[model samples]
Target: MQASNSPSLTRSQLATELGVSVFTLNQWAVSGKGPKAIRVGRQSVYRREDIDAYKATISSTESTPAPVSQPIGSYMMRLPEVLSLSGLSKSSIYAMSKAGEFPASVKLGSRAVGWPSHMVMQWLNDRMGNVA
Candidate 1:
């Protein structure tokens, strides 16, 4: 791991900067599609230069950078918002999640949980048949 004083972005920070989800970053890391990260104890951190290089490579191949899928505030949604968006009640949501029919909630604390907005949106999009 690089020195803590060195410039680096934690996985969550990089996900925010790149307008993606931490879950997405994890998938990218596993598939070797995202910027290289250094393991720092139990967490991963991306060096500033590595992120810049990754951005450059992406820009070179794509006409334009990808747009942010969701607003910063909506990156994670509490139960209520998820319920409203999906038009499902709390019990139904929990049931569906348990059955693998819904995106599972991320644990925010001992009693708090949230769903990644991107995943929920993707699920909705899939159900809607990619409707605009």
Candidate 2:
């Protein structure tokens, strides 16, 4: 049964509306991990209003910075990794780094910088020993 009042979308149509690749939408559907969808054989269908509702539900989530995953054997650590291993918030990390109280990050490229792994590890060990 179709609802005449609400607009609906095919997989490609919804992917275009969301500005994501069709494969991504398909993966989401297959994994049951994204906007609600109906699967009829290989085809997936979505309601425009449902997509909008899904967007609203996720609108309040905090946007984590890029490079959320740590690279294996990475010589340098990005902000996410530092926070995970150091138990410090973004603001505290930056404030301490600026104040020269924490290990400073090194320039990796024109727009990217990271902390040396050894230095961060040393800082962690030092912190553990010093804290009461």
Candidate 3:
């Protein structure tokens, strides 16, 4: 992770890294939902270090997020990628998604779509809670 003194990143870049819309991240800034951003003249930027710090904060605050080796909010993933990461069959994933038992996918194009890696992670955490 870069330090607080690292170079800055545009909002678009951060949005891609976190698998969220730029508009959503902008909302986070306005609503104080995500990490604090740096303002360079008329642009909003953030340091890599700040993002890492924010992840650390989230990880620490979560009490019992499943038993996964890593937090869900760390990366973006596609459907096939998610299947591999989760070890769930494709049919099960679709059923879960329809039942709101999983995160919804975001449309990338007319035919292409993807889900945020973190949402899948959160869903996994939620599943762990249902274990009997």
Q: Among these predicted structures, which one has the highest lDDT?
A: 1
lDDT digits (tens) for residues 24-98 of candidate 3: 998999999877799989999988778888879988897865754536346557789989877889898879888
Name the best candidate (by TM-score).
2
Name the better of 1 and 3 by lDDT: 1
Write one digit per residue (lDDT tens) for candidate 2, span 71-114: 45648889899999999998998899999999988888999989
Off by over 4 Å in 3: 1-6, 63-132
What lDDT is obtained when candidate 2 is compared to the true structure?
0.82
Local distance difference test, candidate 3: 0.80
lDDT of each: 0.89, 0.82, 0.80
Clashing pairs in 2: none
User: Which clashing pairs does model 3 show?
Assistant: 72-118
lDDT of the structure predicted as candidate 1: 0.89
Misplaced by over 4 Å in model 1 are: 1-6, 64-132
lDDT of 3 at 61: 91
**Clash tally, candidates in order:** 0, 0, 1
Model 1, 1-132: lDDT tens digits are 333345899998888888899999999999999899999999999998999899999888878658747556568889989988999999999999999999999899999999989889989989899565
TM-score of 1: 0.44
What TM-score fits each model? 0.44, 0.48, 0.42
